[model samples]
Target chain A: MKKIMNAPDAFVAESLEGLVRAHEGLVTFGAGRTFIRRRDLAPGKVAVISGGGAGHEPLHSGFVGRGMLDAACTGHVFTSPTPDQIVAAMDETDTGAGCLLVVKNYDGDVMNFEMAAEMAASRHAIDTVIVEDDAATGPSLRSRGRRGIAGTVVVEKILGAAAEQGSNLAALKTLGDDLNRRIRSMGVALRGTTVPENARETFSLGPDEMEIGVGIHGEPGLERTRFAGANEIIRLLGERILAEFPSDVAEGGTARPLLIVNGFGGTPPIELYLAQGIAHRFFENHGVVPARTLTGTFVTSLDMAGLSITLALLDEVQFKLWCAPVATPCLSW
Target chain B: MKKIMNAPDAFVAESLEGLVRAHEGLVTFGAGRTFIRRRDLAPGKVAVISGGGAGHEPLHSGFVGRGMLDAACTGHVFTSPTPDQIVAAMDETDTGAGCLLVVKNYDGDVMNFEMAAEMAASRHAIDTVIVEDDAATGPSLRSRGRRGIAGTVVVEKILGAAAEQGSNLAALKTLGDDLNRRIRSMGVALRGTTVPENARETFSLGPDEMEIGVGIHGEPGLERTRFAGANEIIRLLGERILAEFPSDVAEGGTARPLLIVNGFGGTPPIELYLAQGIAHRFFENHGVVPARTLTGTFVTSLDMAGLSITLALLDEVQFKLWCAPVATPCLSW
Candidate 1:
């Protein structure tokens, strides 16, 4: 695989080093470079932390700054961070108002974050909010329920704002849980990502076939389908997400959805914007006017050519929190 | 050529439609969707307008909003917009303070923008600032001197803020010219982008070879070499750019450079951040501290897997202008 790196094994560490160096004013590395924390953490505020694999950049690390995440523990590409790393993040970010851990619903991630919370409970108040917003995985197939995907960004944004407003640990956890249940995401991948250590694509597909409902980590998608136009792909993803929305949010026609057209690393912004437009029109035709829309590469796999559509049913308070000002490396408004 | 497009020929128009719809509150399309302008155009401020080929997104179009370009005209992929479109942008954006056209130094772009300036001269005051910062082609190679590349983003950011601060058209033109002359850039491409109309990659390369000094529109680069590590590639590009710096900016060692590690669409954020680290060290080793560094996919060539380095020597005033607040769909600060 062609990639810009010094050594395959050192890719994640070196990239993290580069990130800290590039945004020195906004973030800093922890004791062992296993976690990153905001440079200026406010006292008496609930600390919000999140992490997963390293490939989905601007997710955990990039969100660590003012009005967002207080810290993030990072793992190697498509791998979970160790419990020790999660503890490091918690120790560095807890400001007495307590700490909130936003963990994606992956087996490894859930276990590690839970262990970290147990480890940190003696010294500081810590709580975990598990996010499982992916609609592609049915309830019967997996005991872990749906895997968290791009909707994690929405959860992070809302919870980050709520935490910054001096919300206690329990309040922030409740907010995160509520938002996670309201959000749903699904993706389509045209190509697979190449992990540096493996030096090979995670999967392969026919030239005219696409993996619908693909996971961010190149997990097996629901099915292989014929390649089609943007509108069709968007419609399929939208229909699945809308079908699974809570009946109160879906049936009453009073749902004010917040749309996120997330690019899966290698997709260009032009196509993402086009997808956003298609998704917006589709929602409008179905009698829903989105309250807010965010279109960019918020979450990604390593050089994967695909995208995900996320819809979060928003209440007035949640919508207000989503619109709250944020200052981070990847997101600032 | 796998792309998220409705139809090959409809790509540009449809993409623009999506852009306008996605940023409905911030921007609006001119007559016939030929140009996009900020909705809240301030009267009596110099209007900065920029455009070129359509493929390099988030460049001209994404830069339109507060503290940036007042309007942008888009052409087909890798093709220049017509004079009529440029005229339309000028007519819609020009206030009492006149208008400034920021055109890259491509043959078609320069010619078309020049013709549009002449056409619009009958009604409104219009001036043009040509950007030619690429150091790949020597002065003697082509009459056009050098091709404009990613440095155009830097120019727009500075000039956009200057215009917002009520700089007149003449002053904005001079500032753009000064900054263009001081800036130098070089790029490397791992893959060629596929133009929508062509339905084929612009060029091909051996699996282990990379094109250095590649142009935004997939123009041939200076050389094809075996792929190397990130540090080596960055050092090579940095050396070329630093070597071509004007005597004043290079000799005194007092120059505060603004660095832009721009992704060519397909390169992930991890690689770009790593590149930024290497570039930062390269400059520091040479006894220069970058006053400001912006790293992201600001300028891009569709889905080309590569990146470019732009170093613009900055005076205190220009650096301040660069930090000014601006909000747009793709960019916010």
Candidate 2:
């Protein structure tokens, strides 16, 4: 790839500096350019924070705002943020309300956030919520569970909005748990992306093949299928997602769900919208009453050619909270 | 150029359905599949709306919410939305509040939205704000300016927030006009992205050459330079953007402008951050204190391999409103 940089090793630090400079109003850095919130925290408000490798643009930092995360810990590209970085962000944004750590269900991310949460709990009543949104990542009832993908943003936004509205840490944790159960996501990658530092491709794909239900870090998806239009692709993915929801939920007696169609980096908005269209039709065919839908590159792989669809069943309270105001780099209220 | 689609023609409708299915809480569509806001509009709010080609996700539709846009029109990939579609959205979202049409600097988008505004204004006090945010496009002093690119999003968000805060159509139009002066964006493309329907490349570039200051529709950038690292790329692009700002603006105490490092589709987050780092260092060296910075794929070129940088100089009011609450599919408040 034709990239401009002084040195490959210097990319992360320089990039973080650029992020801080660009979002100075909402983001800042501590020692070693570790990410932190720019605002002064009110005393006694629990600081909910999360972070991961730097490659995901809006993942940790993009989510730092009023109705979302208080701060994010950033690591190197496609690598987990260090425990020290997470601890720093927690210290910077922590209020007596105690901090909640929202982590993706990735092995590295889980281990790192888990260690940080344990450290925070040792210091205070810090709580944590690990989001396992990607159904493609893990077995339903086994080791580690699903890998967290784009759904982390929804979890953080929903929970962060609740926290901003002054929900107690315990209450927020309960809300997080409940919301987690109601959400599920799956992705497909048509092509691979490269990590600049490595200067090598992350994964390989046949010219005519797509790996459905792929992972964000370039892990293999559930199955390989011949390339198809977004409609067919989404139908297959939505059927799998709908299968996970309670049949009663699909029947829509009393519940409506929020849908997210997220692009895995190189996928364009045009393609995402097409995917959204197909998914919407699938829901209508299934007799589900949709509440709200989001389509875009919310969470992403580093220019991977793919997308993920995440569904969150929202009650009135969740809906209202989701609508609350927020200010961060990537998203607002 | 590997894609997972059955045919190009089915991309848009299928994608829209999938998006609604994925995000039923935030968006809804008419029987004909026109995307709209989930909430009903008040009778006296000026219905500000915009849309163009399908690649620019979250621009028209994502900006629809409280304190932002009322509704958006969608088009096929890189194509302007039909006038009928724009009219339909206006009728649904516009109450007594006169509608404001915010069109990018593109010839197609401008002509289409203008025609629709004229049609709507005959019945209502519809006004329009033409955004020439891409300084690289419509000549600053010429009748025809540069095509609006990613910077259009900033203009739309700021004006939309003002409208949500009860600004009338006239006031919102003025804000939009003022934003056009305060905003400037320039983009670069390393590679051209192919539309799924075409299944063929839209533009071509040498494997080692990068197009700087390129237009969104795959037009060549200001320069086709040898690809370098992030720092070098930032220097090349930053000089143009900084120079575009009048010496008085840069010299006069502006509130350090907001910086947007937008990807032209296929560029990876790592590369964007690397570019962002370079941009930040350039600003730091120049003593330009950026008030806010956003780095992501805002306006995209199908899957083009490049990124753009946008600077929006905000006055106090615009700054506060920029931080206001919003809810949309792609962008949150």
Candidate 3:
């Protein structure tokens, strides 16, 4: 587990500098930190901002651009960004129109971003949208508040596109709520990732085993499962997400859904695509038309060797917003 | 190594199906994979087409979309697409504006794409641009031509953006040639990635050691060296690339270049970003200003545990084009 970092502590700061240097045209920031807001922020448009730990490359920060998030706060690898940093990003990207804080369902993310959002709301008219789409871990009741996973990208993109299209703060919140109703995600990890500065594995998983319902922080999944083929894996995960679909979409069967085949960390695009093939066939066989799809590393769990699937059931307007141009690093469609 | 795949042979076809299904609005293909092109190809733009082995996730196909590649020919994992498939892509995407083929410097990629281009040239007046930017293996002038690595993205993006702006085939070739002169890439791998179906590692290095200047196919590199810190690694690779910079850009003591910190399959984005940080500091210390930077799994070697760096010396026009909008699945900036 050798790595090429200078020092464990300097890793985050140095990485941000490099990111800014590379994307100078689309990004700019205050001296001394990683919060780079989108270059062209309009005063009248509500801003969407999100961030978390640093390990998930292109997640919160890389997504800060047009038709996506307007600002991102980067924490240390696997650690939540401080509430102060989140507040800084909110302030930097905030125009008179207000801001939207999209927090993942993780305990750290929820607490930190919520605190920042509350702080912002006290100072300004900032809004918030919490995404909790993970369907893997649950007691299916009060404890079943879904953990945010790769599906956060779909939510952010939809909401961001709506925000870009002059959706007012109230309109944006309605769109965000609509996005929440239509989205569900689940993931499994075959292996754990090594933190570069640590020069060691973050968590341990049996080489021959995989865990379904895995979270991004290398959190233990609901259960350890035997390795299976792509089709079986998709069927197992899809069944859970499908069960969560709204009765109208499932019963009426008139609306089409957007599919997202998201790689966790180290899984190759080839494997993700294979999993996607299975998920697509299963969804199509269920008479649900997939109107739009995104396949790539949207939200990742460091280098966890697995993937997640997100199904965003869309209305006509949501479908149109989903197809809007996005200028993020990893996503553009 | 556990993988979520059905059969080794079925990986490519299944992945393609999943890709198109997921990106339903952006991509379309014929049955039996005869032709695959973006849904947004305009009326008379010069089609920019390129392809090789299937392992590179977004290279030939992930890049197919508006403002980027018009079409791409995909083959089996790490295998070149058949001539018939390449010819079909050319025919479908090529209008009277002609087409430009961007082939990597590998023997197989060059041979296969050249053959397809020749086949297309027999009927349509098509031009080709061969990129050879892996400076670690070149500079002897007599040795086998330089190996192409991550620099392919720069070339493809510039050519694709130029084509999107309605550049003719000849103009696109000129831009590609200029980029070839400016770009250089080198890769290091800690371990090799296994083929999906077989789960057999393609190339081998020691657990604690790394190979520099390796090709994408897990082929032997120009050197086998002990792993060092990111600064030292970037210094070594940067020195090699800087040696190849054109005198005009390198002369004014302002040789600002675009940086690409690429992951060779297994390397995580966290480690890649740390490495990019070190690489940036080293370049700045050496009197080089980095104009643009991208760090991710642009071209991969399955799940090989490694990273590659590409430095493309940027002129004014190149910098502007690099900052241009590129709407591709894997990369967008």
Candidate 4:
């Protein structure tokens, strides 16, 4: 693969080191560089921690700072972080209130973070919330349930704000579960990503083909279809996500949705914005009024040329929390 | 050829429309949607305007808001904005304090922006400053001088703050010129971008080759060398940029440079951060200390798979101005 990397094996560690160095004022590395935490942690506030593979950047790590995640445990590309790393993140960021672990719905990630929570329970109050907002997989087919995709960003943001506001561990856990139930995401990949160590693309497709409902780890998408226009692609993804919305959120009553049109790494901002325009129209035609819209590359699948649309049904309090200010390297408002 | 776009010809306009829609609170479109201006413009502050081809996103358009460019005119992908678009931007953003036009050094860009300045002069005071900080092309070889690349972002940030602080048209122009002279940039491309209209890659390279000193518009670099490690590649680009620094700035006596490691769309954050770490070490070995560093995809060449490094030699005044707070959609620091 043609990539700017010193050594394939050193990709994850070096990238984390660079992240710390680049945002020196905002974050620092824990002992052994297993985890990164904000420089200044508010005393007696619940610490929010989340992490997974290194490829989907600006996810767990980039969201670490004052208004978002307290710490993020990083792992190798498309690989889950070790339980020890997650434990270190928990230990480093725990102030006194407790720690909240935001784990995505991958088997490896769920197990690892759960193991870390069990390991750290004696020392501090620890809770793990599994985010299964990916609506790509059918509910009954997979034992692991829905895979977590870009909706993790929405979970982290709202939960981070709630944690910062002195919410207890139980309260944060409830909020996370509620938010995950309300959020739905689906992605379409135009190309697969090349892992640093592989030196080749993980998967291949025909020139005129595109993968719909693709997972973030370069997993096979639900369907491989001929490439279509931007609006058509967005409509398929949007309809799938909208159809999966909880009954209460799906009804066009008083619910206002927060839309996230996320690019999978390689897509440029122009395309993301174009997708957002199409998404706005899509929602409008469906008789839904989106309250807040976020369009950018928040979560990515390392150099994958694709985009995902996430719709999070927000209540008044949730909308306020979503609108709350955040100060992180990748996200600042 | 895989991309998320509707019609190739409608790409630029549709993208701009999405930008205005996404950041409706911060910006609005002109009468013909040729230009976008800040929603709230200070009555007496000098207006800062910049524009060029559409492919290099977040460069001229994303920087339009509170403390950055008052307006930005956009053109078709890799094509210069027409004089009419530039004139519309100038006319819409001009206040009693006059307007400052920041143009990158390109034959078409310079000619068109200059013509727009002439056309807008009768209605309001207008001044133009050309940015030519690309050190890849020698001064004597190209009639238009060094091509402007990522340094244009630096010029916009520094001058945007100065303009917001009530700097007049002449002062802003001088500051832009000084900042432009102090900045130097060079890039490398692993792959070329595919413009929507073309529906194919702009250029092609061998499997194990990379282009050094590549232009933002997918132009061939100064050399096509075998691919190397990240450190080696960064070292080469850094050395070339450092060697061409003005003697005064090169002395490194109390000069705190601002470093920008920009991605050309397709490069992921992991690779960009890895390159940043290597850049830091290269600067340390060369006895140069970068006071501030901004790393992300600030300037991009559509979906090109490569990156560019820009080092702006900043003095105390410029550094302070850089630190000043500004609220824009893409940049809010």
Candidate 5:
């Protein structure tokens, strides 16, 4: 493969090493050598830690800094972090207050983080908040509940802000869960992803086709539709997200929703801003004017040509929390 | 041809429209509609304006904010802005102190910017500092000299800070030229770029090969070689940059160099950070520890799969300028 990595097995460690080295003042490695923790933790503040696969970068890892995530545990490419890694993160950031795990809705992630919370319960009071805001999938007990995607970033930002204000672990968990319910994200892929270890692409598409609602792991989406113009494609994705979004804050002009136009690695910034424009206009016409729009490759799918749109309905409290300043490697606002 | 654009001919305008809409508080379009000027210009401060082809985004337009470029004139993709566009930027930003045009080392750009400065001479004082920091090129006068790449960001940043500090037009120009001389940048492409208007890739490589010293516009470079491990390839690129780098600051520990690992759009953030780690260790061995390493897709080639490393020997004066606060749409420090 043409990946710029030394070896497939060393991807996680090498990547983390580069990250910690590049951001020496903000983050550093923990005892386990996998998870990252803030170099200087806030005294008596609830530690908000999150982790998952390694490929979707700047998510859990890049968000570690002063006002965001206190620590982040990373696993192998597309693999969930082990319980030991989670507990280590808890130990690194937990002061006398407590620790909160911001887990995604993946089966492995949820289960592993749960075990880690139980394992660290004696040392630190622990709580769990699972982000399951991917509205592309239906919520049914039979199916693996709605898989968390880009909306996890919204949850983390709000929860991290709440925790930074000295909210207790249980309070932060409640905020995270409520914020997760108010956010929805959906992805569209013009091309599929490939694992660094594999020498071939995991999936391929026709010359003029895209996968709407594709998962971060190259999972199949709601449909493999024909390629369309930018406006049409954005409308399709936005409609799907809006359809399943809760009515309690559907036309959220009260506090004004936050919209994020995230690129999946390969898409250019020019296009992401274009997508943000289409999203803003479309939503404005639908009686929802976003208070803020973030456009970047904060969440990615390796180096694939794709993008995801996230809509977070913020109340007065959540809106204030969203406006809180964060100084991280990937995000600065 | 899978770009998220409505029409090929409308690429530049649509992209700029989206950019202006997304960052309404920071920048807006000028009279000619091809240039962008800051929303609230600092009174009596020297205005720094930069522009070139449109595709290398976040270069000119993204830097148009509070403490960066006062104005940015954009042209069609890979095409230089016309004299009219440059004149419009000059008139819009030059508030008695004077205007500085930061042009790249391209024939079309230099010619057009010179014409614009001459045309606007009677109205405002305009000086120019052309950046030619691409080390892959030889300094043969006949040969187009060196094409400016990611190092343009360094020039803009330093000059922008200098301008903000009330440096006169001539002083800012001198700083810009000196900063250009102190910096050297080289790019390696795992894959080539494609113009959206064109339906095919501009250049292609063998399955196991890469293009070292590739230009931002898919220009051929010094060598097309086999792809190697990250460490070895970083060494190759780093050595080339260091070799052509000046002897005055060859072992610059006194003022500490600033190293930038810039992505060519298509490379993921994880790989870029990995390259930064390699660059840091590699430069440390070479007796230079960078005062700061800003790694990101600051300047890009329309989502091409590649990256460039920029090394700048910053004297104490310039080091302070480099560390000055900057708040822009794409860059913040």
Candidate 6:
């Protein structure tokens, strides 16, 4: 595996070190490197926190700032953060209003965040909003249900805005849960990622084949099919996501959902934007125009060459939350 | 070649289509498809325009908005924009104060911009600033000296800010030229890029090899040597780039030049940020601290897995220009 690093074991820590240094004024190390803390912590506001594996970068950490996450507990690549780390994040960031844990629907993540909540049960009034927006996996595929993927950005954006606007922990949790149910995402992988610690490729695909419905952690999808053109690939992913959305949002024939074409690390912006164009046309044909579109490497799996499509149906409240001012390292408007 | 594009021939057009569609309120297609025009073009303000091959995302195109370029001409991938395209861009954006053309120093780009400037000689007061900051090449390598690369972003940013502040074309040209002289950049490629039209890999390297000082277009650099760890590799590139700087700027013990660690497509954010940390340490060890650092996939060779480092010495005026607000899709502050 041709990966860039000094010591493979120090990959996650070094990357975190660089991130904090680069975004000095925005974020800093929190409670002993257990999490990244936003610089401006408005007391009495709800503390929004989230974390998962380290590879899907600029996710939880990059989202830490004045209008996003208050703190982001980081785990190793594709691994869950220890309950101790989550506790540290909570201990350091929770305001009197309380805390909202934005947990992705993964076995390890759910369990760890739950454990952390239990540990902090006495001091903080906390609520959890689990994101399970991946359309590929569900109760039929795995008993655990869908694994959260790129739609987490939408969840974070909306929830963070709500938190910043003085929403209580319970209200933020309700908002996050509603947003999660409205969003659906699916991805295709042209290549797999090499996990830096062991230097092992999470999965491999033939040169002329692609993985359909792949997760962000380089997990194999439902099908390993022959390679196809960009339009066909995006169509497959888009169709899956649309099918999973509520009929009112997907079949409304006129409502324009927020569409996101998120790159999986290796895919460049040019291709992501091209895919966005194809996706817009595909949705327009289905009578749903993706009016608010975002294209970039927001969520990634190391060096995996692929992308995920996310669609979120936002009401006036959700749209207002998204439009609120935000200043973070990876995202701001 | 594994690329997310439909009908390689339409790669550039499709990407531009997505860009304009995504940034509807900020920009639109000018007169023809030849250029992207800023939607809020201030009448009588100096029109800052730039164009180049289309592979670099957010480069000339993504930088068009308030406090940035008034227009950006688009060319085919890795190919210069035709003189006609530049002329169209100038015709659409030139205000009474005139237009400033920001051209990258390439045989084709310089020639085309010069021809367009001559063509508009009577109608608009056009001044051209050609950027040539690649540290790996000079008189010994090619008659044209160094080729322009990632540093073009800085040039556009500073000039764009000055233009927005109502600087005339002549003043902007002088500022741009002086900024160009103070920046030096160098890159290394772990893998090469395949030009999409013909599916041609611009250059090739063995599994255990790397190319040093590689240009952004997949052009072979100063050497192709065995692969090494990230620290040693950054040290070599850092020393070479530092040698090209003026003695006063580089040799001064306390001065800090703005450092840019730019990725060439395939490398993900984790690795890029890690490299940035290393590059910072390397520069500090050489007695020159890189206080202002910008790291991202700014300038790219399509899907090439590598990165470049650029250091620009900014005086107080230039620093303030860098601090000016820019509301573009790719970059904003």
Please count the clashing residue pairs in each candidate, in the order shown: 0, 55, 5, 1, 0, 0
By summed lDDT, which 10 consecutive residues of candidate 6 chain B come out lowest? B247-256
What's the TM-score of every candidate structure? 0.98, 0.82, 0.88, 0.98, 0.98, 0.98
| Per-candidate alpha-carbon RMSD to the true structure | 1.2, 4.5, 3.4, 1.2, 1.4, 1.5
Residue range A105-186, candidate 1, lDDT tens digits? 9999999899888988898888888888888986668998889999998899899999888788889888888887789999
Interface RMSD values for all candidates: 1.0, 2.8, 2.1, 0.9, 1.1, 1.1
What TM-score should be assigned to candidate 5?
Answer: 0.98
TM-score of chain A of 6: 0.97
lDDT of 2 by residue, B3-52 (tens): 54547776666655555555556667753676555465756778888888
Q: lDDT tens string, model 4, A232-326?
A: 99899989988897787677463768889999988988888888888888987887767889988878888899999998888888888888888
Q: How many clashes would you count in candidate 5?
A: 0
Question: What 10-residue stretch in candidate 3 chain B is worst by lDDT?
Answer: B248-257
Q: After superposition, which runs of candidate 4 have C-alpha atoms over 4 Å from their true positions?
A: A252-254, B252-254
- Interface RMSD, candidate 5? 1.1
Q: Quick one: best DockQ, which candidate?
A: 4
TM-score for the B chain of model 5: 0.97
In candidate 5, position A255 carries an lDDT of: 69
lDDT (tens digit, per residue) of candidate 6 on B257-323: 7889888889888888888888888877877676688878888888889889998878878878987
Which should have the higher TM-score, number 4 or number 6? 4
Compute the interface RMSD for candidate 1. Answer: 1.0
Quote the lDDT for B104 in model 6. 84
Candidate 5 DockQ category? medium
- Rate residue B309 of model 1 by lDDT: 94
Q: List, residue by residue over B217-297, the lDDT tens digit for candidate 4.
A: 888789999998898899889999988877877875647788888999988888888888778778878877778888888
